[model samples]
Target: MTGFVVRRIGFYTFVAVVLAFFALPLLWLVTAPFTDTPTYEVKVPDFTPANFQAIVEHPYALGSLVNSIILAVGTAALVVLFASLAAYALSRVRLPGRDALLYALLLLSSIITGTAAMVPLFQLAVTVGLIDSQLGLILILTGGLLPAAIFMLKDFMDSTPKSYEESARVFGASPLQIVGHIVVPLVRPGLATIAVWALANVWGNFLMPYLLLSDVEKQPAAVIMYTLYTEGGQPNLRLLSTFGLLYSIPVVLMYLFVSKKYGFRFHGGIKR
Candidate 1:
């Protein structure tokens, strides 16, 4: 009894500490935007709108958010579309070395990240007239994200009972129709998962947009936030914290919306 009590106390204490460790930064993010002068150390925020006003006054602050939305949405759509098709095909059709090929592609994408291939990517962008273009940046992001996405979604497709597709086919459904009507509806959680993942990845991404895009107005919030620093290299905590607060809201809202709509739980392609 004594040992059990001690262990329970220790586990609760550890959990509490972990919660505080994460909660403090989040608490600061929520409160700092309302403080007149945001500081590094968290405190009771002196309620004020000065931080938001400062952000609005900045020339590109709001515009950067719009740019980020465009990029994130565009990238997510493309990644989800390609991943779904590829995942479906891979799940349904068994070709030689299929599993090996999928794992190899995922492995290669992980190893050759955007940073590692930036030089070649830049050269390709310049060759294809994608440099300084938002569409170009979106295309690059979509390419980088597709491999992992397709891999992640393949299991969801596999879990779907073949009886559903077989039934659809008996009713004269084409492969594309079966995918669009039956498979897609059944595997919605997977699609939602990929969409959210792709959006989050694109939302926080800085490197691809920074390397591919040169125009100030075209820069996303992740890249734009870097310019919030002071000239002497110190971070402008006020602007940084304020923008950080707003910068995080969209993704959070998106997550909440998706969670409410489809949820993240997977149950063998059926909601049961």
Candidate 2:
């Protein structure tokens, strides 16, 4: 009995330690922004708005947030639209070597990561007069994300009831109409999942935006956040913590809204 009680105590202690390990960073993030002089340590904040005032006065801080919104929304919209169509077609069609092709594309995308393909991507963008353009960045991000998005959405498409499509066809509904009305409604949860995924991916992305956009005004929050440092290479914890909280809000809000709406379940064709 003593040994069992000791084991139970040990387990609870370990769980508490693990929880504290993850919780401390979040605690710092919440408390530091309001501190008069924030630091690495999580101390009681002085509850000052000076940090936010400083960010508001900064030239590019708020504008960079707007740029991030534009990039994340545009890329997510394109990814959802294209991924849905491609996944639907792939699911419905019986083409030779289609599965092999999908797997090949997925493998290639994974192996040839963004870092490896940036040179070719940059040259292509330059050649096409897309350099320093937000649209170009969106297109590049969309292409890179499509393979995985399609692979995931394809499962949803497969799980969808084909009888609904056949019924629509019997009523003389065209393929596009059927897809727009029938398939889309059933797979909306999957679509929301893809949109959130893509948005988060593009929101936190820095490398592509940093390399593609040379103009300071055009850079997103991810890029602007990097400049929150002193000339001596020390991080300005005040502005950094404040901006970090503000930067995290939009995505968190989006996730909450989506989660409340659809519960983030992979229901596919099963109507909720």
Candidate 3:
């Protein structure tokens, strides 16, 4: 009894420590933005709105957020649309070497990451007159994201009941109609999951956007945040923490909205 008690105490203590470790950063993020002189350490904030005021006055600070939304939304919309279609087709239609093709694409995408393909992608963008264009960046990011999105969504498609689709077809439903009314509704959780994943990925992405978008007005929050540094390359913690807080809000709000809508728990093809 004593041994069990001691082990339980130790486990709880370890868990507390881990929770505190992760919570410290969040605590700092919430407090530091309101602090008069924000720093790395979390402390009682002086409760000033000066940091926010400073951010509002900075050129491109607010505009960069809009640009981020544009890029993230555009890329995610395309990814979800194309991935759903491709996954549905792949799931319903068996082709020669279908599994092999899916696996090959997934493997290639994983191995040749954005960094590895950066130079080629840039050159391709330039050749196609896509440089410094938001639409071009969206297309590039969508292509990079599609393989994995299709792979993940295909599992959801496969798990969906074929009987429902068959019932829809009996009503003389076209393929597009069946997909729109039946498949999409059933796989909404998966769609939401992919959307949130894609949003977060593109939201935090700095390298591709930085390389592709030369104009300051076209840069996203990720790239703009990089510029919030001192002349000597030291971080201005005040602006950084304040901008970080703002930068994090959209994704957090999106996650909360998605979680409330779909509950994030799924079994087979249904949201549980």
Judge candidate 1 at residue 241 and give its lDDT.
Answer: 92
Count of residue pairs whose backbone atoms collide, per candidate:
0, 0, 0
lDDT of 3 by residue, 1-272 (tens): 99999999999999999999999999999999999998889999999999999999999999999999999999999999999999999999989999999999999999999999999999999999999999999999999999999999999998899998899899999999999998998888899989998999999999999999999999999999999997799999889999999999998899889888878966444443
Candidate 2 lDDT tens digits, 1-272: 99999999999999999999999999999999999999899999899999999999999999999999999999999999999999999999999999998999899989998889999999999999888999999999999999999998999899899998999999999999999999998999999999999999999999999989999999999999999988898999999999999999998899899989988777865454
Winner of 1 and 3 under lDDT = 3
Clashes of 2: 0
Taking all chains together, each candidate's TM-score versus the true structure is: 0.94, 0.97, 0.96
Task: Write down the worst ten-residue block by lDDT for model 1.
Answer: 263-272
Q: Which portions of model 2 miss their true places by more than 4 Å? A: 269-272
